[model samples]
Structures are given as structure tokens and as C-alpha cells.
Target: MEKVILASRNKGKLKEIQAILEKFGMETISRDDAGIPEFEVEETGTTFEENSLLKAQAILDEAHTITIADDSGLEVDALEGAPGVYSARFAGENCTFEDNNRKLLKELEGVPEEKRGAAFVSVITMLFPDGRKLVARGECRGTILTEIHGTEGFGYDPLFLPEGENRSFAEMAPEEKNRISHRARALEKLEDMIREKCSC
Candidate 1:
């Protein structure tokens, strides 16, 4: 089976990516499983594509295999995208999901529903040792909820309701949300690219 190494240590992210690839009948390994040494790829790039490409290339060098990397963020309109690339450490280093979410809510307090516009952006890139690469982006446009809701998902899911839906992402079931999530959408595009070009 063809295998993929996902360049992330986040279990939740690993799980989601693994499941999607598996559905396409590809084997996958999480970062821990890939036996990579401790390393950090600086996300100094301005755009998501640049950051994801940097990470994927680093992992391909270390693993010598098809590796995929992603960088995602929550962009709030009112904040003018205050926490786009900094979503993970919005509150500070070692910040918890609740910590970031709490701060977002506070900053968004009293912001009317119409102006609470936002969207989740995800960029996924795949790199191989042979100098071949593919990149794709997915986005979920939604309004930020004033208060958190549900407990199904972590991060800003609790306060995000995808466009045309009344329920927050945190309230969505795994399969349900996966079908419409920003990452999922990006993965779907990658899936198509793989099917068209990579499948043997």
C-alpha cells in the first residue's frame, strides 16, 4: 500500500487526515509513527501555502516519502484577521483551546450578528522526495457565534457556524463536520489530484 506521512503532531489533525486518506485506500503514518527527530519548521512565510510547503519539504527530507503538511487558521472579520496564522498561540505559547476561544469571544463581545463574519481557511500541501509537490486550499465561510456552543470539536469550532447553517461546528458530528470542514474540503481537492495523477 502507498503510505503517507502527515507532518503534524496533533492527534486530532492526524486522525482526520488519516481517515480521509484511508477512505481513498492509502496507508498513512502520523508524525510520531514516522520516527522523525525533534525539529521545528519556522512558519515565517506570509501565506498558508508558503508555510505548508516549508513543512512538507522538511518532512520529505527527513522521511524520504510522500509527506503532507497543512496550516490552518480562523480569520475573523471584525478583528481584521487578528489570529490567522497565530490561531494556535493566540493567547500565548502553550495556550489551551478554551483560552483562545475565550479571548476571541471577549474581543467580539457586543459585535452584532451581521458583523461577526468569519471563515476558516486551511492549506494542505504534499511533497515527495523527487521534487514533485501539490498544494490546495479549502475554506469554510461562517459567522462567529457570540458564545461557545457544544463540545464535539476543539479550537474555535464552538463559535463557528458554517454559512447557511444554524448549528456551530462544535455541535456537528465528526462525519458530518468532516464533510463540510475547511480541511475536509481541501483534502477532497487533494484526493482528486491524487486519484488523477498519483494512483497507480
Candidate 2:
């Protein structure tokens, strides 16, 4: 199987990516597990695509192999798409998920359901040592609930209710979420591109 280094330490994310890429005959491993030297890859980009590419290039430079990186976040329409690139640090640096969720709820206080529209966005970038690069983007439109609803997911999953669904992401199983998540959608596109290039 082809090996690819994932430029992230989040185990959940690694698992998700692994499941998606497995069928493509790709083996995904975290940067730590791949024995890559740890160096801060600062997210200085203003957009998800830029940040994803930055991280992918940083790892590709170090490992000289195919590397994948993703920049994803929850975008609340009412917030004017705020917490975009800053999603990870929305509640200040090193803040917990609860802290960020609390802040989001507070920000949308008094906002009706109709205006609570939001979307989860994922931008995945794959960079090869030979200077080839591929980028894919996916989005899941949903609404922000009045309060957190489930306990199974991380970040803002508990508060996000996808369109045509009654349960929040946190309420669904990993398989269920992966089947319809923004990351999954992005990976699906990436898979299609790969298939087209390889004529598989």
C-alpha cells in the first residue's frame, strides 16, 4: 500500500482519514508515528485551503513523501463566517471545546432558529514530493442548536444539527458521521480525483 503522512496529532482525525483512504490503497499515519521531527507549523493562512497547503508542504519538505493536511472549522452564518481560520483558537489560545461552544452560544443569544444557519467546512491538501498538489473542499450545511445536544463528538459537534437530520453529529456513531461529514465529503472528491488520475 502507498504510505502517506498526515500532518496532524489528532487521533480522531487520523482514524477518520484512514478509513476514507483505506479503500484507495493508501496507508495514512500521523506525523508522530511516521518519525517526523516535531516542528511548529504555524497556521498563518487566512483561508482553509492556504492553511491546509501550508501544513502539507511543511511536512512534505521534511519527509519528502506524500503528505496530507486538512484545515476544517465550523462557520456560523450569523457570525459573518467568523472563527473561520481561527476556529481552533476561537475562545482564545488553548481554550477547551466547552469554552468555545459557550462563547458561540453567547454570541448567538436571542438569534432565532432561522438565522442559526451554519456549515462545517473541510479543506484537504495532498502534496507530493515531486511538487504535485491536490486540494479538495467539502461542506455540510446545518443549524446551531440552542444548546449542546450530544456527548459523542468533539469540538462543536454537539451543537451542530445537519440539514435533513434530527440528531447532532455528537449523537451519531463514528461510522454514521464519517459517512456524511464534511471531511468525508472532501475525501470523496479527493478519491474521485485520484481514481481519474490513476484510471482506476
Candidate 3:
């Protein structure tokens, strides 16, 4: 199988990416797995596309191989799309997942369910040593629940109730979640692009 360097250290993100790419005969490995020294790539981009490309390009430069990266976050309509790019640090730098969730709930306090519309967005960028680049975006519409739901998944999963689903993302099984997540949709598009535009 073809191996690709993934410019992310989040284990949940890694599992989601791996589950999708494996079906395409591709394997993804973290920078550490490739023996690359640990380093932070500042997300200096204002948009998901920019950040995804920045990380992918950084990895490509270091490994001189196929590299993939994705930038994903929650965009709550009530918050005017706040915590989009800053989703990871929604509470504050070095905050825990619970802290971010608490902050989100606090922000949405007293907001009606009708006004709780939200969407999870993912932007995937792939870079090749031959100067080829591909970008794909995907989104899943949902609403922010009044309270935390389940214990599975990461990030904002506990507070996100995907449209048409009674349970929050955190309440769904991994296989079920992987089948319909924003990352899964983005990866599907990326797979199509790879099959059509590149040999790998």
C-alpha cells in the first residue's frame, strides 16, 4: 500500500483518516511514525483551506513524500461562526475538551433550539513531491445540544447533534460516525480526486 504522511497528531483525527484511506489502498502515518522530529506548524491561515495546505506542505517539505492534512472545526450559527478556526482553543490556550464544551454551552445559554444551527466543516489538502496539490471540502449540518450527550469521540462531538439523528455524534458508534462525518465526506472527495488526477 502507498504510505502518506499525515500532518496531524490528534489520535481521533488519525483514526478517522485511516479508516477512510485504507479503503483506497493508502496508509497514513503521523510525523513521529515517519521518524521526523516533533515540530509545531503554526496555523497562520485565516481559512481552513489555507491551514490544511500549510500543514500538508510543511510535511511534504520535510518528508518529500505524499502528505495529507485536514483542518476541521465547528461553526455555530448562533455564535456568528465563532470558534471556527479557533475551535481547538475555544476556551483558551491549553484548555481541556471539557473546558471548550463548557464555554460553548455558556455561549449558547438561553438560545432557542431553533437558533442552535451549526455545521462541522472539514478541509483536506494533499501535497505531492511532484508539485501536485489537491483540496477538498465537506460539511455536516447539525445543531448544538443544550447539554453534553455521550462519552465517545472527541472535540465537540459531545454537544453536536447531527441533523436527522436523535443521538449526538459522541453517542454514535465509531463506525457509524465515520460513515457520515465531515472528515469522511472530505476524504471521499479526496479519494475521487486522487483516482482521477494522480496515480497514487
Q: Report lDDT (Cα) of residue 87, candidate 1.
A: 90
Q: Write the per-residue lDDT of candidate 2 for residues 1-200, one digit (tens) a residue.
A: 88999999989878877877788888999999899996989889999999999999999988988899999998999999977888878999999999999999999999999999999999999887776778989999999999999999799999999999999999999889888999989988888777676432
**Candidate 1 runs further than 4 Å off:** 10-26
Candidate 3 clashing pairs? none
Candidate 3 off by > 4 Å: 10-27
Return the TM-score for candidate 2, rounded to 2 decimals.
0.92
lDDT (Cα, tens digit) per residue for candidate 1, span 95-136: 999999999999998999999999899999988777788898
RMSD (Å) of each candidate, 1 decimal: 2.2, 1.8, 2.0
Query: Evaluated with TM-score, which candidate comes out highest?
Result: 2
Ranking of predictions according to TM-score: 2, 3, 1
TM-score of each: 0.87, 0.92, 0.90
For model 1, state the Cα shift of residue 118 in Å.
0.8
- Kindly state the number of residue pairs that clash in model 2: 0
Residue 135, candidate 2: alpha-carbon lDDT: 91
